[model samples]
Target: MAPGTILLVDDEENILQSLSRALKLEGYKVETSQNGSDALNLLKNQPIELMMIDVKMPQMNGLEVLSQAIKMHPDLPVIMMSGHGTIETAVKATRLGAYDFVEKPLTTEKLLLTIDNALRFKKLQDENKDLKDQIRERFHMIGKSKCMLELYDKILKIAPTSGRVFIFGENGTGKELVARAIHNNSTRKNRLFCKINCAAVPKELIESELFGHEKGSFTGASKTRKGKFEIADQGTLFLDEIGDMHLEMQAKLLRVLQEGEFERVGSSETTRIDVRIIVATNKNIRQEIEKGNFREDLYYRLNVIPFIVPSLRDHADDVPLLVEHFLKIVTSENGKQPMVASDKAIEILKQYQWPGNIRELKNIIERIVILFDSPNIDENHIIQVLPLDGHIKKTRFEGKKPLRDILRDVEKEVILLQLQRNNWHISQTAKDLALERSHLYKKMKQYNIDRGNNSY
Candidate 1:
């Protein structure tokens, strides 16, 4: 197969003919244009992997064509050639985005080498662009509910500022996603985005982990190291679960935020940094402050721009969209053809309380995609994958609630789920749950389940 298509533009017919023969003999498909106008037409009409243009052409000079071509396809690789080549002209071409400049009476060997290098560079550039697109897709938020739209607007307004952000939400509600969206849109986006989970890290080592440490600062301190703050200088540092941080460490962190500097463990030398701080927690920070678990001053300092990420249950209307998004992603990852959820399946998924929120939804979708071999997932598939009985442990099992109340809550959830699955047809729901029609009606009345939201 031909390696790639090459476009050669020159005013001289003989030069074009000779160059075309040389490139074709080396397994390249070549197109020749006698002037800049014809060359541009080729570029516009078809894909040209690379181009070699003479700098001195009639009507329109090679430089003019090069400029316009760059505008049309900014990443196109172009080489400038001229029998009357000058250092000044070569510099101008290079500055105009020419891949490389070659002089006329070009040696076949050198010409081939230049073309090879340019093709390799072009491949690398294309790969880099693809990788960035993949990253953006991976972190892309999928929702169109009113709450999500409002949150998106808030993120856009807050991203350009350098203010400290405090994001609050339940676990699995994507609080870290909010932080990431802010950092990716901020002025420091091109820099590092360092993150550390305050709750996951040990209290004894939290200080060193944040501020780094000097060699011999303590046992296992083998070498001098920089902390998240130092490494994230001029970027953004995400402190996840900041409410769980020790009070002493919170004081130290408060000082760093105030003075913009800190000393490494076992050293008194202060190191200053310019980092954007974004903190996230699933706990109620105000309650933490009132209970004396978190610092009130630090809470006020970091809460300059507060964000609340709504839990999945609050935006149940977006569940169908989220299901489709996860289905495509999971199927693609597993090298399988894309699958879709049936309407009934989606309805059952939406009715779920999602105590674990979006994270749980994604996990269940992945499990379904892997275990089931169907192109369309129906309600039975979801019922098989979801642990419907125990899915409410997180939402209904708070220690303060009595056992009787907890059982009652779980019973209500199960009955409601069954009702939704049966499309609120009371008889069908009663049969599915093996309950008498009168008993089901009594339970519905006790739980306030009504036909207002669904047809009976």
Candidate 2:
């Protein structure tokens, strides 16, 4: 079978016939045209993956034809041929969008190789485009509420700048989504958009993770490595859970922001990078500063463009739209029949306070799709999947309690909520909270929280 179709365009009949026969023998379906005008007609009318055209054609020459063909199909690869080949003519063909220029009498080996390379290059380009399309679709924001509209406006305004962005939002409220949207719209969209969870990395290794270390820099440094900052050069770097960074690391980060450079761990050589920083944290930055948990100078430096992503509970009206969107995505991914929710079921979802925000809501929709056999979901399905303690508990700010104590109370409530959602399964709850099982157990012990004592 022919690998792909190729169009052969030349004013000379013998050259066209010879090249057509050669390409046919090489497993390409070949079409021959004796003039530039006929070649352009064939290009417009046929599924030609590649075109080999002569520069010294009669009426409309190869360069002229190349320009029109490019306009017609910008991705089609064109090769120019001429027995009277000159650097001037070759350069003109190239500027006019010829993929390559070859002198005739063309070598079959070289011409075939060029055609094969062009086809492979086009295939790679198409695949890259398809992958990017899928990413854009997956990260797309779905909402038209007043808050969402305002967010969209802010993203558009900030996307064109090179400012440091500090996003304030709870976990699972899509802070990462906001960062990606900004990067995709920015001038550096073609470059990398690297990310690191500041809290996820161990404190001992966070510096190495950001600045990269030389070979044999430390105990387990097996090979030289480039860090997030180096990898994100000429691109955007998203730092999640910025408030959780230790004070010493914060000072190092401040130095990088101030000087646009850093020395990798155990190395004296400094590496400079041009990276746009975007940081996010669910913690209150001002409170962290007051408590001496975060650096004041670093906060000011990173807070150039602050965005407060509204919590899902604050925008309950968008619940119906969110539910429908998640339902379609989940059903399609799971190869299940399309599912819709009853009006009453949607109302119940809207009324419930989503402690875990949009992330929790998405999980419930997925659970319903996977566990239930019904094509249409009703209130019972929603109720069964929702956490038992669906209501948000009001945290009482006692005047006599210290600020730290009050913060602890809120943290305990959050842990308890996640535990109930996971049915007191420590491992699952720990995973949900982005904590190691041992750390979660320590928190449970610190709060004296026990499943037997507290009823969901």
TM-score of every model versus the real structure: 0.73, 0.76
Top TM-score prediction, candidate number: 2
List all candidate RMSDs to the true structure. 6.7, 10.1
- List model 1 lDDT by residue over 375-441, tens digit each: 9998768866877664453645767989999889878878876776566789998998999999999
Per-residue CA lDDT of candidate 2, range 97-171, in tens? 888899889788988888888888889888998999888887888788899999999999999999999999988
lDDT of each: 0.90, 0.88
Q: Could you tell me how far off, in angstroms, the CA of residue 409 lies in candidate 1 after the best superposition?
A: 12
Which candidate number maximizes lDDT?
A: 1
Which residue pairs in candidate 2 have backbone atoms (N, alpha carbon, C) closer than 3 angstroms, thus clashing?
A: none
